[model samples]
Target chain A: MRFLSKALVITWKDALSEMRTKEVLSSVVVFALLVIVIFNFAFGASQEKMLLVAPGILWVTFTFAGMLSINRAFIPEKEQGCLEGLMVCPISREAIYIGKMLGSLLFMLIVEAIALPIFTFLFNLPVLSLQLVVVTVLATLGFVAVGTLFSALAVNTKAREMVLPILFLPIVVPLIISAVKASELALSRESWATLASWLGIMGAFDVIFLVVSFLVFAFVIEE
Target chain B: MGKSYLRNILSAVSFLLMAASLYMVFVYVPTEATMGIVQRIFYLMVPVAWLSLLSFLIVFIGSILYLRKKQSRWDVLARSSAEIGIIFTTLTLITGSLWARPVWGVWWTWEPRLTATLVLWFIYLAYFLARSLAAEEHRGATFAAVVGILGFVDVPIIGLATTLWRGIHPGALIFQGGLAPSMLLTLMVSLAAFTALYSLLLLQRISMKNDEIEIKRLLGLTAERHNTGDR
Candidate 1:
């Protein structure tokens, strides 16, 4: 019960900060939009080519924008030393990881939510379906689970800004590949059985990292 | 310190084993009926690729040990293993390219095996960069260890991805079908030799690291004694 309250409090704290600042969300959305426009110009062609490349473009934009928001998610806590205070609080370290992960996920989801319609309009694809939305959330959850842990790790390093992606992308490549493939399958209205294995792979990745990060968060958060 | 003698023997054995493996690869092993002489590269490529993945496991294991124990020796072992892994991975890529050039008509293709190998190379290179670019301390070691552990999680995925997603790479040796008895025996021998060589390299690196620490400790002691004498 206490842990739940602590998590809620931390989540609210993060959401309120973002609401006031609007720094992370705006940057991610704008960057994603810019990427979509650039991709459109670069790959200008008929509808078939657009359909083929659209998934790749959407994932790339989401990944880059996700990195931006994740990096910023911890900066304020780090700069003001609030992270130290939070660490001293009588909450589980896993709660802290979850709270931060949720904040980043919310920020990323907002960017995706906004970016999707824009992407649909710009690329002339139909709005994504319920199944696609669920897949995106699952995929994004996997990305954030790994990203959250890594961002916490990287935020302590000397080259915090540059280190996150270098540390992250390689580890998360499997997730991105599987997710993008699954997303493409979903978008194309392919049989779910064809993508069942990829979805399983993604789910397995998310569960493994989630547990691993939860176990290690205490060690990482210890100064 | 007495382990130096054992290490020397191990080094000699490693050299002899590598020479024997080379001889087997070139002389004893018959060339493939289809791919001709260039196919012989697989003799080197397979073992090196196997060792490369083995090194990742070593790194992962070493990292877990380091994280649990906070021992500097494990960090050194992990770092050295990762470095050696990179070397073997480079050889794998080069040899794979050599084989591809002859068979696949192009020097390179986005084939799953080739792409995965390239990604693995970049990942380890990033691991080294992450380690070296940080200050030489526990923080750096821990950070690198974490990345090492996480990075290794991709190895099996890459292996599986190549198999799952249809591409030009051959299916995994174990699962696709049974190999001929002679081929399997030869592969096992080569794998054993490579594993022995990898251990030899790791032991030598660990001993060298120990010597370095001892030398640093001796220097510190001498500096402290000299200051006291002067006072």
Candidate 2:
């Protein structure tokens, strides 16, 4: 309980700071919206054809925006040397990992929450469904679960920006594939039975990576 | 002395077995009826694929030991294994592609195993990039060890996801039926030969890395002594 609360405090601190600066959220939202517009022009498919590509475009937007948001998870601390301060705090390394992960997860979810409605409105697709939301959260959870760890790892490297996606994207290929499949089924209003396996994959990915990231993050963030 | 002897024996064994396997593949084993001449690449490809996977497992184990013991030797082992692993993985992908061109009618397909191998290739590249770009030596090793661990863990998940995604296609069985005894024997020989080659390369790389570290240490010592002399 105490650990959860402390982690929440870190998340709350991140939220408060973002709310103050309004940097990541605004940029991520605009970036996501622009991707939707550009992909629309790039594909230039008809309405029926649009449905076929929309799920991919949607996930790509989320992924890119999520990367943008998660990339900031550690860079600011690194630049400002707040990482040492965080490490010196009265918390386990695992708590710090959870805290950063939740912060990124929360930031990404908020971006998606804003982006998804705008996406549906622009494409004139009825993609606003509970199932889609569930898939989005599950997929996003897995994304940031691994992303936060890599974000920390990348922040320490010489090519900080270049390293994250290289290290991150391949690892999350399963999540992205599962998310795209699940979203396709969700958009098409498929039954739960059809969607279960993808959800399972996303769930398995989330669980496996979440535990692994939590364990390995200590090695990454150690000074 | 003992290590050099082991290396010499390994190289010799690898040379002899490779020669024998090459002969068996070219002359002894009957041409696979379906793949014909191109099937010969299979002898080289399968062993490399197996070695590639083995290399990462070695990396994974070495990384865990490095973290646990904090010994530079473990890190050296992991680094050498990863370097060798990347080469083997590249060979696997290239050979797989060459085999696929004639058999599958295209140089590439989104087939599950192919997709998995490609992703593994990407992961190996990422591991090397992470290592090479870290500014400090020990830090680079630690960062790479983390990558090594994460990359290995993610392989199965990537494989499963690609398999499920490609569930639309009937998975191609590598061989339609069990291998003939003669072909199996050839495969065993090739696998052994490749394993020997992989170990030989790993041993050579580890020694080279140890030498590099020793040189660096000596350089740092000389610089420190020069500074003291100036003071």
Model 1 ranges off by over 4 Å:
B167-178
Q: List the residue pairs that clash in candidate 2.
A: none
**lDDT digits (tens) for residues A1-223 of candidate 2:** 9999998888899999999999779988999999999999999969998899999999999989988988999899989999899999998888888988999998998899999999889888878999999999999999999999999999999888777899889999999999999898998999999999899989999998899889888988888
> Each prediction's Cα RMSD?
2.2, 2.2
TM-score of 2: 0.95
List, for all models, the DockQ compared with the true complex.
0.52, 0.81
- Residues forming the 10-long window of minimal summed lDDT in candidate 1 chain A: A213-222
Q: Which candidate leads in TM-score?
A: 2
lDDT of 1 at A164: 83
Across residues B27-61, which tens digit of lDDT does each residue of candidate 2 receive?
99999887788888989988998898999999999
* lDDT (10s digit) by residue, model 1, range A1-223: 8777777788789999889988767877888999888988898878999888888888888898988988876766888888889888888888998888888888888888999988888877764876568678888998898888888877777787798888778877777787677778877888778788888777888888887777766655567
lDDT of 1 by residue, B142-205 (tens): 7778778877876777656654655334355333455556666667677778888888888887
User: TM-score, each model?
Assistant: 0.94, 0.95
What TM-score does chain B alone reach in each candidate, compared with the true chain B?
A: 0.88, 0.92
In order, the interface RMSDs are 2.0, 0.8
